[model samples]
Structures are given as C-alpha cells and as structure tokens.
Target: MQFQILRDEEGTKADFLDLLENFKPALKEIRTATNQESINEFIVKQVPYTLSAGELESIWK
Candidate 1:
C-alpha cells in the first residue's frame, strides 16, 4: 500500500513520529492476524464490491 503525507513545514518530524506511534498498535493487530485463511474469511465476509462492465472494459482497454 502507498500513502502520501501532507504537512506544514513546521514540526513535520514530530508530527510523523506521533503518527507512527499511533499506527503501531494497528500494525501489531494486523501482524497478529496475518494468516491466509483469516484473510480469505475476511474478504468473504466483506460486502461484495463491483464495477460496471463498462468500467471494467475501460480499465482493460
């Protein structure tokens, strides 16, 4: 996954460090749940999402 960080010039490092600290717990939770069967189950339980045939065709083209 990719992320873009937008911030003011002032105190960027402190802001980034704080963001990293806050994300640690979420990362740990994801790490603990890192298994293929669990991931497949999660995807199955999620509401199915789709695009129109026109949209898919546009992407393929």
Candidate 2:
C-alpha cells in the first residue's frame, strides 16, 4: 500500500508527526529531507502532496 500525506508545516505539524508516530510500524517506507539527503535513499523522497492539505486547517479554528 502507498500513501501520500500532505502536512501544513505551520499549522498541522503536530498532526503530521502524530500520524507518523502512530503509523510508523505500518508505514513500510519513511522518507524525509534529512533521511534522503544524508543517506540518499529512496528513489524520490518527496512527492507533490495536496489531497489533505486543508483537512486540519480548521481543526483549531
């Protein structure tokens, strides 16, 4: 299974991190700037993400 997660760094960083933490085990692959840059792993670490960009925008509002 593949998943593309869109996170609003300024607003939903917590939500994003929570998702990663909660689903880390089920997440077969993990890629980030630090991981990719330091290790050059994964074909493409970053993919265009816009599906859930605003899913949590109004959670606090």
Candidate 3:
C-alpha cells in the first residue's frame, strides 16, 4: 500500500501514531511473508518515520 506523510508539523505525531496502529496488520502480514531485515528495509522505504528500535518492536508486537 502506498502511504503519504503529512507535510504539516502540527498533527504529525498523532498522524504517525494512528498510521502505526492502523497498519499493524499489514506490518504483521509483511513479517510473515519476509524476514525481519527485509521488512525493516521495506518499512524504511515505504513509510515516512525513522522508526526507532523500541517503536518498531512495539508495533510488531
């Protein structure tokens, strides 16, 4: 799925968190189909955030 990051800073955090929450299933599906390394690479390529280790772990769970 194609995703876009909002340009405004005002709602960035909430927007990102919402996307993270909503995209959990898709993320899990990707993980199931690919290795963690590949999924991480794909996330970095597809999403806007520079997700930290903790954040990545939280979502994956």
Query: Who wins the TM-score comparison?
Result: 3
- How far out, in Å, is residue 34 in model 3? 3.6
Pick out the ten consecutive residues of candidate 2 with the lowest summed lDDT: 52-61
Question: By lDDT, who's the top model here?
Answer: 3
Q: Per-residue lDDT of 1-61 in model 1, one digit per residue for the tens?
A: 1113422334343343444455555544654334534633442343133334443223212
Per-model lDDT? 0.38, 0.36, 0.64
RMSD of 3: 3.4
Backbone clashes in model 2, listed as residue pairs: none
Candidate 3 vs. true structure, TM-score:
0.53
Q: Model 1, residue 25: what's the lDDT?
A: 58
Shift of residue 24 alpha carbon in model 3, Å:
1.3
**Worst ten in a row by lDDT for model 3:** 1-10
What are the models' TM-scores?
0.31, 0.26, 0.53
> What's the lDDT for candidate 1?
0.38
After superposition, the stretches of candidate 1 with alpha carbons farther than 4 Å from their true spots are 1-5, 8-11, 32-61
List candidate 3 stretches off by more than 4 Å. 5-14, 46-48
* Per-residue lDDT of candidate 2, residues 1-61 (tens digit): 1224442333344444355455444432544546434422221244232323243222212
By TM-score: ranked, best first: 3, 1, 2
